[model samples]
Target: MHSKRIRAILAPVATAALVLASGAAAVTAAAPAQALENGVARTPPMGWNSWNTFGCNISESLIKQMADAIVNSGMRDLGYQYVVVDDCWMNSTRDSAGNLQANSSRFPSGMKALGDYLHGKGLKFGIYQAPLDKTCAQYFNSYPGATGAQGHEVQDARQFAAWGVDYLKYDWCSPSGTIDDQVRTFAKMRDALASSGRQILYSINSNSVHDKTGPRRNWGDIANIWRTTEDITNEWDTGQTNGYPMGIQNIVNVTVPLASYAKPGAFIDPDMMEIGRGGMTDTEMRSHFALWAMMASPLIMGNDVRTMDSATQTILKNANLIAINQDTLGLQATQISNDGTRRVLAKKLSNGDVAVALFNQSGSTTTISTTASAIGKSGSSFTLTDAWTNATTSSTGSISAGVPAHGTVVYRVSGGGTVTPSPTPSSTPSSTLVSAASGRCLDVPNSSTTNGTQPVIWDCNGQANQRWTFSGQSIQALGKCLDAPSGATAGTKVQIWDCNGGTNQQWNLTAEGTIRSVQFSNLCLDVYNNNTANGTTVILWTCGSAANQRWSRV
Candidate 1:
């Protein structure tokens, strides 16, 4: 890990307790500071960074080439703007006046000149810095000297402004301090940028690949964009490379749960993208780009743009996915369900459309599905447009596809009215409930009338225990309704209890064949662990496209 230090600042005890109680890293030590209202990154910033592809090998000429390619390849028209030169662009040491300078050998044209060249081509300029005495490469790559901003936050901010820097990637390379100290240090830079007489988009990496402190929640309040996971490498699934979790799937897992923190101006960055990096399959690359767009993450390309192939260009310039990422609603897609191998995410667009992504993580091709209602949509008719191929389909609600291994199928669904939970249907006749995975009946063991009797998948038997009736959203069998116990959570075993008309007992029989609990719509009646053996238990798990969670009436 790169080493750095933070000047300490005491925080109020009560404020610290409040943040800690909420399960967030305590960052209340400093006086409250708001993210700069620079009117940029209202939607997640779209740009390119040199780190993933070039690392510390950046130079003025290479950045110019990227800028020229972005414009000539029509990427600029599609919103790829900022051309950021990551660490190593700075000299190993400060100048006589204690100001940081561009490495004279690589950036002979100078920082301002490089920025001017990009601006001349209708692009923006971005740069990197650390809060400590050395950047990650300065320590790890043995690049000499103390180039970090540390106590010179104001001076560096002004210098960046003077150099026409439109974005700042403030990294937490090596830091010595409490979480409070880190927050204070980052805030000082934020303040410096705000006072720098320019609107620099503030991006910070408080949790580097080497840091184990996890992401701090208050980052949304301190910077426009904040890194939520370790640096992402060009791989499809989790594997450690240089101590960082390297893969698209690993970063997605780390970022999905942080959706609530993203809004119009604040974005939860999962790190720059690795699309077209050659380490992942084309399918996996599509999945990666779609996932980032769905999550409202910054679309900072880390691939060498100057020589990208047509397929790479196509994926990078996907207009529909780009629009979804730049949606004015600025809401990050929520992981509605994940069954280890299959995951479903949904985000609402400002124009009354909902974007849904069905991702298959397993090695084999699998059928994945979700319903409009499950994704917070309902209507008599809906239009589904495949985000990649532009294939259009109409449906009442069902959305499904045979997604390839490590692939994602994204759909922009429109024409659905906002969902309004309907009252229970009037006296629906009893039917045998069969599990799609087990081909067995949902049976109450021994025909037990005892309350709290858990349901299980058993051999299809023509008995009262296997007969279930739907009434006003309740699934009744043997004089009881299927219920999720109070305070029930994912993995909670579902049981038969007296139907008191509670939300937990109400279920939405979706068109895609899922029986979703109304109380927790994101969960479904899952055959435990996808085990098809007779007498397997039934529990509520996240609503995924997995067959174990699917059910049918007979």
Candidate 2:
């Protein structure tokens, strides 16, 4: 997969690709780069990037507008600082002295002036490049040519420092076929960045092909954040790769398994976020943000900030979730339990509190509960606070709640019984949503991971959309309360509405596993036409002994 990944850079005109690929200036040793002493990126880097929103269509005006928006929109006050230009910022060819040049038309002010503009606004500037003869973008797209730091790593590093660049995302596009070559190539750039006498947070990108190819290189010793997966799209839970883009939930599943490899100075990056892209439901976006926060991931937003709505802005700037992410301990959360339907993940914080995410991996609203000891906490009583809603509650040894399909409930629980006052929380799934028909589960359509994501029935694939729980006497999924439209007749669609403790939102799961609405006991939960395939619509029908009406927890 790394062989197929693409990006762009600049090179000289005289047979540039051939020259950089000749191994003329290749370093032979395999070691971590010498780190600078500026205390840069002591924790995961918080920033914004260009690739997800604009791709190769970046300009000085756009960059300047984004910098202004971050300050004016209060994102800077919320701890988002860096503005990175990823890929395609370089010209087709370098200058006479073999210096990489910013595309003159798009960046008339030059790289130095642009860096100064960002610095003047109290923000940092970051840039991207490939360690190979060409970037993944150029190679995969079959462009005329591309460039790298292969022959002139030191010169490029010096130029970047001179331009006051604070971060660099060094990708391994079209790199050599061996792991040692990749490591040594990155080390060459790392040492070059250090020799320039500037404190740059060096980010090394791993070859996605080599991600599962046996043992991994020591990227943490040299770079701040190493990419763990391919590009992330606005979708969710898709592992299908035809050299195409990925979704937010799919990326979460990819990076969740690599938690042990993350730490304070170095992190496992899933790639830039696609928030405010209008591709996912609000609930899906919240899950994406919270999961990335729990992973201690580099929160580099990849969306158009200048036009984000209030809800999008609020999710990105959630102070409590950000606090859990930026906590000094910098511990990445790990999955602790998976009982075929629900999965629980927990991260021990530096503040003696544990951040827990109860993920419902089923479709129907089921009771998903977990004890404190199950999450590595040794206590009888604990105080819990929801990060998104800012709601506070206490739990004895275990906490149970009804979550909606494909929803999550994230809470910060203090060790033992030390109750701490906190702010409110938001629409987050606290349990898994399961279905009773054909042993299937409720899920977001097409595995959609965004707000206002609708629920549908799908085979139990253990995805995020299939998670739901019954908390507070309401069927909830994707953080929205499951309800039949007000005064709807039988066979009307059951939709995910705002949780309001209304009668339509309440359901009774009888001892026979039949789910009946409290507002209308005569109607029972039923799959449309007894369809057993995925995407089947669920509706209220008269109670019967039919297989479609016989509900049971799997």
Candidate 3:
């Protein structure tokens, strides 16, 4: 299924490349000559797009109503400034002189008048276009033979700027061209917007299919926010579609690896959101919002602002979460741990705090946790505040919570930035791993001298494996490192291995009496399934405060 999708997208691109190469001069001639240093979009853009909710149904009246609702609903005050018209706004064809025209039937007052109205409401106006000869929604566009901005880049940009457009969303509907061709076309638009004497936010959508590790252009160099995934749908979980249909989770997976490309002036977009829509619950909305913020993604709301409920309003207006998103540091979060059923993500905030999210991906509710050490903060204590509930707590080491199925618990953890050194680094501390619940020692099966021996809980027999030495971030059992296997996931059996400096072998004994692994960033040494019986097996899982995950070294 995935291969066919890739092939379908690539074929057009390859054909377009040959055509573009043949007419290179004509394409270059269309590029704008003048340039302006438009350094807008220092922070991630927050606005409302007309595509996800309205699609091809956008009109001048709907836009005006949305603008009014944005102000009255306090969205404008919350820093959502742009009112963007996505696609299908253009007329059937350009004028005799070749200028794009608004659909007379839908936008009789024209785009300029609409931009003026939005500006009067203190909102910026955004316009959308396709770089190709036609957009994906070409059938609904202005005219039968309507051309995109491909051969009229400068002219279209000037028209948009003359219409008082403050933002430009350039889509890659017909993505056929070489890497240089794509870059030149995008740079042409960027140069055009710059020369238009309008400091418009240049947003490019190269389409997510081009995002894989390949000879693709660096969109971050020119775009304020570039779509990194498929278009989002109004679903909480995975959505089914004929083409690429993305839900919140699917988008996050696509966004996980593109963190380094994002910064103050640019962000990796996961496409427009479906917040406040009927397909998802409030809990799912909260999760979606938190993840987007943590990723430093553009918050382009895609719901009918005039009709959403109060819960949706509150989630959208979350000032604290928004602040994290617009932080001057502009660092996107990365997935710290994912063991199939549960996952943990952490982002570093500008104020020396970490925004951590524990997500329950399973169908059933599960206990999840992560320690301060797991997030690069060891020794010091942390104070956590639930971003959604405003609940507060402090932990010297680990934080745990019972997360509902498909729900997320986001916390802002402060302090714990400095790692306190051991009283004596040269001295290795030997201790017995006493389970906080069973009061038994962590024992190597049968006191075996072989490698790959799994660990277990047994009566305090003072065996070599039970009597472990901790030093230099490694816990050694019988001269081998107590370890979780490489690429270990939840329920992967824990065993002993030769003391290699791998992350799976590195351990940190936290102040809260939980063991953390550097390799599994947000995972902890946990007893399998709350089992306290002898030989119950030990493994790495999402951190939790349950007795099974708690241990004391003595």
TM-score of 2: 0.68
Instruction: List the candidate 1 regions with Cα displacement exceeding 4 Å.
Output: 1-36, 208-214, 239-243, 420-554
How accurate locally, in lDDT, is each candidate? 0.77, 0.69, 0.72
Look at candidate 1 and tell me the lDDT of residue 518: 98
Instruction: Give the least accurate 10-residue stretch of model 1, judged by summed lDDT.
Output: 19-28
RMSD of 1: 13.9
Clashing pairs in 3: 13-176, 91-142, 92-142, 92-143, 369-543
Give the alpha carbon lDDT tens digit for every residue of 1-554 in model 1: 11222222222222111211222111112112234466778889998998887776778888888898999999999999998888888888888998889899889989999999999999999998998877878766656654899889999999999999999998876534446677899899999998999999999877422221125344778889987656677888654322255468766755665565678778888788888889888999999999999999999998899999989999999999999999998888876655446778888899889999999977999999988887878776999999999999999899999999999999999996865222221112346667766667788875555678899987764344665756658887644679999888899999987657789989998776778999988889999999988789999999987778777776
Instruction: Determine which window of 10 residues in candidate 3 has minimal summed lDDT.
Output: 24-33
Give all TM-scores, in the order shown: 0.71, 0.68, 0.69
TM-score of 3: 0.69
Best candidate per lDDT, number? 1
Ranked candidates (TM-score, high to low): 1, 3, 2
Who is ahead in TM-score, 1 or 3? 1
Question: Stretches of candidate 3 above 4 Å error?
Answer: 1-37, 139-146, 208-217, 239-243, 418-554
lDDT of 3 by residue, 207-241 (tens): 53353211133367777777765567777755332
